[model samples]
Target chain A: MKYPQGVKRNQVNTPRADKEINYGQRGMTLEKDLDKTNQFYLDTKRAIIHKKPTPVQIVNVDYPSRKKAKITEAYFKVPSTSDYNGLYKGRYIDFEAKETRNKTRFPFINIHAHQVEHMRACHNQGGIVFIIVKFTVHDEVYLYPFEHFVKHWDAYLGNGRKSITYADIKAESILLPIKYNPRYDYLAAVDEFYFE
Target chain B: MKYPQGVKRNQVNTPRADKEINYGQRGMTLEKDLDKTNQFYLDTKRAIIHKKPTPVQIVNVDYPSRKKAKITEAYFKVPSTSDYNGLYKGRYIDFEAKETRNKTRFPFINIHAHQVEHMRACHNQGGIVFIIVKFTVHDEVYLYPFEHFVKHWDAYLGNGRKSITYADIKAESILLPIKYNPRYDYLAAVDEFYFE
Candidate 1:
């Protein structure tokens, strides 16, 4: 598959070579699914959640006209918080979502240190915080509450395994079933995990 | 009075000609003051608020090396939500801040319609929503509740005044007194307005 100009390989990971993957699921990334789900929720008047924009450090901007401002130089910044956060049912909701092709375990490398710190802070303050993990090879998704995710994170800090196995995630997290309008209904999992 | 290269006049409003303005209050913009205040709140474990990064639409990037991915083309997107949001005392807190030099009234031209809509959604979901207005000429700040601000905004939509008068704001909103560490103790005002 040809990528658009200036697009990097790792940035747009389209697993076209995986013939085992269903044809219907070719381009549905976790972020795109969540965006659709959030929009669905917004339209249904169920929740008001948003994925934060990619953080960038702007350096120089050029204005060719009075109404137009073009950014000429900028750099991406390491995000210091979760990618998704917003209000839900009179409570604060915060979470990070990741999709891993690895069949065995979800590694901790891509998840930043400050984001976990942020989750911990939010959790301590009584906000509903969690991590959503998707295994592309297995075609499975799980929503792990912050309370459980942090235990493994703490263990990892104390010289435990650097990643949590797929089995452990399956056992600890709520299995989010795929749906029509919302695609992956993670908030249903949230309701089952927290409110129920 | 000299601005950095490419900085627009209205973008960087530094009223050096205001002879009545104190010399000590030269460069303290509302955004800078709030950053300091949020940092202070974080350190004290009082709250976990953060300013959303300025949203930019990145069009082209040039990878100079393996480590450096330089953004070559981008543009600022008009923000659809509030600038600041977080969890405070188990409540979802959301707000926008604006500074104006107008002495008599705060105009609605600077505040966008979508931001007010976002605030309304948050307020409907029971989140603590507000707007912080700083009268640069009067050297005073006020935190106006979403319920109150929306009344004037809706009236404006109904062909009323395009702005809210200084007398109305001073009477209806909480006057946020400046302090040393937190600078603008708006949460104290929040507690007084909501919790009390």
Candidate 2:
């Protein structure tokens, strides 16, 4: 396996293709490493954060043994939402983690409608809600609150911009410090956003 | 498709296949419908509720097209905590939804230590915590508060019973009414549990 640079072996998929293949976007490198960091966080119990399961609409399974079954006829399930969430500190934390290698901007299409809605609801209910976006080229990560994202999302229909330029992200979002333990010390930022 | 006479279609996979099911262990069904119902509520502006996505550790994928890919290799990623969670009536709701077919009891094995710990943390934070389980044959659904379930869960680990008996569920749980719009009126039960 082509171990993606700086990823531990135990991570579910820490390897990249032998050669660079297009992911239709840039900077999957950031996505990989951050996931690795999150996995590390989960392993040590430094924090209890996890990416949601891949949605699969199981159609059939072939049980070779009574206890073992191979899902052979299952189809990909279309998710109605984003991919990551969990709890940190004493609050119910919900957010989606995405990365864009594009040095200029992060596409709004990367964020789904249901995800924004979920974030909005959680935010309205006073839960900690935000998104962690990694800009691979800049080697930077920002914790963008769902409030701003949703504001732009609701305005997307009337406005023409479909994404936030790197400049805008830097201006409106909290640039979280990358840490060794939690990797995404996001809750700290939330505290900053909450208390200070 | 057959509307599983024994178990509702939305509540598929009601625990083990070999045994008769109970009515008080229908958490799986309750979780799925609540997710949809929560979305319906969000869309209709009633309340914002959500069932968190399943936690997964994706290992491999088969990209069919530039825009589409199928997961070729993956595993049932270990989840670190509860499954269904959302905000309801300005309260944070966190829970693990599970169903058991065991005729006499709901197995403790159906839940993980992390989930129990998660519920504990949420409850300590003043977030409303509980679990939904359905007993199929009895066609009854019960909402077990986290406070109660955790006690039973730990007792089971300390050489007590392997599962919670039906009588215990009936006594300590709230029986949720079946509603056509949401299927399971868990919020109503939460109202009684938290407010009344």
- The DockQ leader among the candidates is 1
> In lDDT terms, which candidate is top?
1
Off by over 4 Å in 2: A1-26, A29-47, A73-75, B1-40, B44-47, B52-60, B65-67
Query: Per-residue CA lDDT of candidate 1, range B61-107, in tens?
Result: 99986768999999999998899999999999999998878889999
State each model's C-alpha RMSD to the native: 9.5, 10.0
TM-score: model 2 vs. ground truth: 0.76
lDDT per residue as tens, model 1, A126-171: 9999999988887788999999999899999998679998888898
* Model 1 ranges with Cα > 4 A deviation: A1-28, B1-28
- Candidates in order, TM-scores: namely 0.89, 0.76
- Tell me model 2's lDDT, rounded to 2 decimals: 0.70
Instruction: Give each candidate's interface RMSD in Å.
Output: 0.6, 3.4
